[model samples]
Target: MTESETVRLGARIRAYRTMRRLTVRGLAGLAGASPSFVSQLERGRTSASVGMLRRISGALGITVADLFNEDDGAGHRVVRRLERPELPAGPGTRKYLISQRPLQNLEVYAGEFEPGASTGGEPYSHGDSQEILLVLRGRVTVWLGPPAEAVANTLAPGDSVEYRTSIPHRVVNDGDGTAEVLWVVSPPTPL
Candidate 1:
């Protein structure tokens, strides 16, 4: 891998590891490699074989594509004219993407929620990854974990939170006004 590619891959690996709260030793054991090897991989000091990459992806619960995709720079020029696929989660929720395709290190999205809007499903857990949410407008109530710990966080604008995704989590708009959040998912989520 080139230096840039290695750096991007390393960033993705590190993001996933932190999201999962997995130590180098833990991931190394899961990948059947040494801690040193895992560290080298995360630092981009060494390249992993196809088999090894697959093993690592499997251990991380993500696809190989999620780890190697390149940024196309499609929707970053201007804020108003960015064409992004609006993923329909449920009624009253809208999702806008800052990228048309998934990149190696980060996934950016603009999300809007109507009053009483919710993620509209059971709390879901991704692979080894962390999520950051920045509320641009209104207030939102986020619940984390299968036990559903109510997060008493309310954001009017320019407020954000980053958390591990290993536990189940959901976001809801419990206030009267619509909520807008800029969400970034690290290590990318498989399309």
Candidate 2:
């Protein structure tokens, strides 16, 4: 990396660390680095090798590429359709990670569910996030809270729903064909 790139990377690291409210020592512990080393990296006094950058980004719950792909404009970038990272979304379902890293407080994903497929298995919760589900195609039945609560809502194409994610939630696609939906979350907790 050039000297300018190193400094820019350091600034990005500092920004993310501060956003997560982690002390330099805490981040160092997570990244398996000495606090002094972290300090030097943050001050642009040293350049982190690729392996070191990988460990640090992993500690921050971000991919190593995210460390170098900082958006140049007001945090905006157009994500190409085929470039999204695919993630598991239970049986017969596929999810695409839509937002690049350093997403600030936002996380976005697109999910495609086959008939009877769902974001099931174990219902999950995110303590620091709230989510908006926008159905782009097909239909879904979203269960709020635990399965026992039975609080549910069925959403069709063009419909959207917002919910706090502090309680466990899951969604099922019982429609005839594949279901596609976009999820937008605040204070992004990864999928």
Candidate 3:
């Protein structure tokens, strides 16, 4: 491969390794290679032979062709507005999935909430991950914790909050108009 192609290939390998939650040493052990070699390959400081790539790809539980997919696992991609998929949501609410499918370490959603619309009747949890909710327009209330003693924060445009997804949470539109927001989450949760 050319130098640029080699760099991109290294990036794909690194992305796949991370998605599989494998350490460099762990992957090297599985691939029958040295940890230093894997590290060098991932950092674009060195190139791997076809055989080495095969071993690495096998260790990652993917075919060599998958490594060359256009998605590049975690590389640059663009999702046009028209291509965003609509998601099933609670009453008076609409959500668009802004992140690409076969999700990587992160996922995003664009939400539109009509007056009094809420995520659910009660708080909900999403495994163990980090999440950020950013209000883009109108006003909304975010509730975190059990229903009995939930903490509610009313947010306006430009406001954002970060929290752990393990905590039960819900969001509601508090204004008379529609509320627009973005939800950014890491280590994506299943839809």
Output the number of the TM-score-best candidate: 2
| Model 1, residue 180: C-alpha shift (Å) | 0.7
Against the reference, the lDDT scores of all candidates come to 0.76, 0.83, 0.85
Question: What stretches of model 3 exceed 4 Å from their correct place?
Answer: 1-17, 20-75
Whole-model alpha-carbon lDDT for candidate 1: 0.76
Q: Per-residue lDDT for 138-183 in model 2, tens only?
A: 9999888776775888999999888887778888998999999999
Across residues 118-164, which tens digit of lDDT does each residue of candidate 1 receive? Answer: 78667767755778888889888777767446454566678787877
For model 3 the local lDDT of residue 16 reads 75
TM-score of 3: 0.65
lDDT, model 2: 0.83
Ranking by TM-score: 2, 3, 1
Tens digits of per-residue lDDT for model 3, 66-148: 77786645556798988889999999999998977556678899999999999978899965568999999999999988888
RMSD of 3: 7.1
- Error at 190, model 1, angstroms: 2.7
User: Model 2 TM-score?
Assistant: 0.70
Q: Report the Cα lDDT for residue 84, model 2.
A: 89
